[model samples]
Target: MTYPITRSYVAIAAPPLRSIPLHFSAACLTGALLTDIAYWRTAEMMWTNFSAWLLTFGLLLGALAAIAVLIDIFSGRLLLRGGLGWLYIIGNIAAFVVSLFNAFIHSRDAWASVVPTGLTLSIVAAVLIVINACLGWAIIRQRTGGLEE
Candidate 1:
C-alpha cells in the first residue's frame, strides 16, 4: 500500500502595531503637499495655514514613529536587514528634514510662503515620503512572504 504525502505551511505574522504612526505621518505629509499646491494656486491664507498645521502634525507623528521603530528594533520585533532597510531609513530622514525646512518657510507671509522655494521643498518632501512608503511596504511584504491580510 502507498501512503499519501502531506504538506504543512507556517503563517506569517503581521507588522508591528507601532507602525500606525508612521502611516499617519506619511498621510499628513502628503496632505501638506496638496495644501501647498492649493495655496500656490489660490494664494489663500487658509491653505497656507492648513499646510503649516499638517506639517507640524506630520513631524510630531514621525517622531513618535521613530521612537516606535527604535523600540521594535530593540525588542526584536522588527529587523532592518540589508541595504534596502538602510535606504528606507535614509529616505524617511530626508523627507522629514525637508518638511521641517518647508515648515519654517511656510511660517512667513502668505504670498511669499509657498512660492518657488517652499513649494519646491514640499514637492521634494512629498516625493521622498512616497518613496519611503514604497520601500517600507516592500520590506513588510518580504518579511511576510507575500501574505495578504
Candidate 2:
C-alpha cells in the first residue's frame, strides 16, 4: 500500500478589517492586565503611574481593531478560525464594555471626562461583536454538513 501527499494554496484571505476589533480588544485586555497588576500593587497611584501609557496603548489598539474589522468585512472572512473566532468575539465584546465602564466611571475626574473616549471604544467593540457573530454563523453554516477540511 502507498500514500499520496497533496499540496494546496489559499490565496484568498479573510479581510483585515474585522481584525481591527480583535486588535483593539486584545490591546485593551493587555492594558487592563497591566493596569490591574499595577492597581493591585500601587492602589491610588496606579492611574498616576501608568494612565497616559495605558490610554495611548488603548487608543492605538482600538484603531488597529477598527482597521481589522473593516478588512474582515470587505474580504468577507470575520470568522477566521472557528474556536479562536469565538474567543476574539466574546473577549472583545466583554472587554469593550468593561473598558467603557472603567474609563468613564472608575477613572472619571472633574476635568478628565471619559465619555467620548469610552464611547468610542464601545462603538468599535460593538461593531466587532456584531461582525464576529455574523461570521461565526456563516462559518458554522459552511461546516455543518461535513468536515471543514
Candidate 3:
C-alpha cells in the first residue's frame, strides 16, 4: 500500500482591528488636505474649521494606530523585514508632526490660515501619509504573502 503525502503551512496574518485606525487616519488626513484647498479657493471660514477638525481626528487616530503597531511589535506578532517597518514608523511620525503644526496654523484668522503656510503643510502631510500607507501595505502584503485576513 502507498501512503499519501501531507503538508501543513503556517499562516502569517496581522490583526484586522489594528488596521482600522490607520485607514481612518489616512482618510482624515486626506480630507484635511481637500478642505484646506477648498478654504484657499473660497476663503470660507467653515472650510478652515473643517480642516482643523479633520487634522485633529487624523492625529488622534494616528496615535491609536501607532499604539497598535507598538503592541504588535512587542508581542512578536510583527517582524521588521529589512527595516521597512522603521521607515514606515518614521514616515507616519513625520506626517503627524506636520499635521499637528498645520492644526496650529489653522487656528489663526481664516485668510491667513489657508493662504500659503497652512495649505503647504496640508499638502506635505497628505503626501507623507500616502507614502507611509504604501510602505505599510507593502510590509503587510509581504508578511501575509499577499493574503490579508
Candidate 4:
C-alpha cells in the first residue's frame, strides 16, 4: 500500500522578518568594498580611476537598500519596535553618515585621500551591521526552534 499525500495550510505566528537589518548589512558590505577601492586609489593617487566607478556603484546600491527598507516599513513587513530594531537603525544611520563624510570630504585628497578614515569607518560600520544581523538571526532561530519558519 502507498501512503497518500497530505497538504495543510498553516499560519505562522512568529513576527515577520525585519528586512532592514539585511539591507543595512548589504549596504555596509558594499560600502566596505568601496572603501577598499578608495584605499587603493589613495595608494595610486588617482581620483579618476576604477575607484570612482566602484564608489558610484556602491552609492547606488546603498540608496537602493535604503529605499527597500522604507518600502518594507510602509508595507508593514518591517518594524522598528524593539531594541534590536533601534540598534539596527542607529548602526545604519551612523554607517551612512560616516560613509558620506568619507566620500564627500575626506576622499578628495590626492595622495593620502580618505583611506585611513574611510577604511576605519567602513570596517566599523560593517561590524555593527553584521552584529545586528546576527542578533536578528538569533531571534529567528530561537523562535523557529532550529527549523525554517
Clash tally, candidates in order:
0, 18, 0, 0
lDDT of 2 by residue, 1-149 (tens): 88898889876543345444555555554554455444545555544335445554675566567566556645765545557566655655565555545454435542233234433454554455566556555565564444342
Q: How do these models rank on lDDT, best leading?
A: 1, 3, 4, 2
Model 4's TM-score against the true structure: 0.63
TM for every model, in the order presented, reads 0.87, 0.46, 0.86, 0.63
Look at candidate 4 and tell me the lDDT of residue 4. 100
| TM-score attained by model 2 | 0.46
lDDT of 2: 0.52
Better of 1 and 4 by lDDT: 1
Residue 111's lDDT within candidate 3 is: 90
Best of the two (1, 4) by TM-score: 1
TM-score of 3: 0.86
Winner by lDDT between candidate 4 and candidate 2:
4
* CA lDDT of each prediction against the hidden true structure: 0.86, 0.52, 0.86, 0.57
User: What's the distance in Å from true for residue 71, model 1?
Assistant: 1.0
Order the numbered candidates by TM-score, best leading: 1, 3, 4, 2
TM-score comparison, 2 vs 4, better candidate: 4
Error of 3 at 37 (Å): 0.5
Candidate 3 deviant stretches above 4 angstroms: 1-17, 145-149
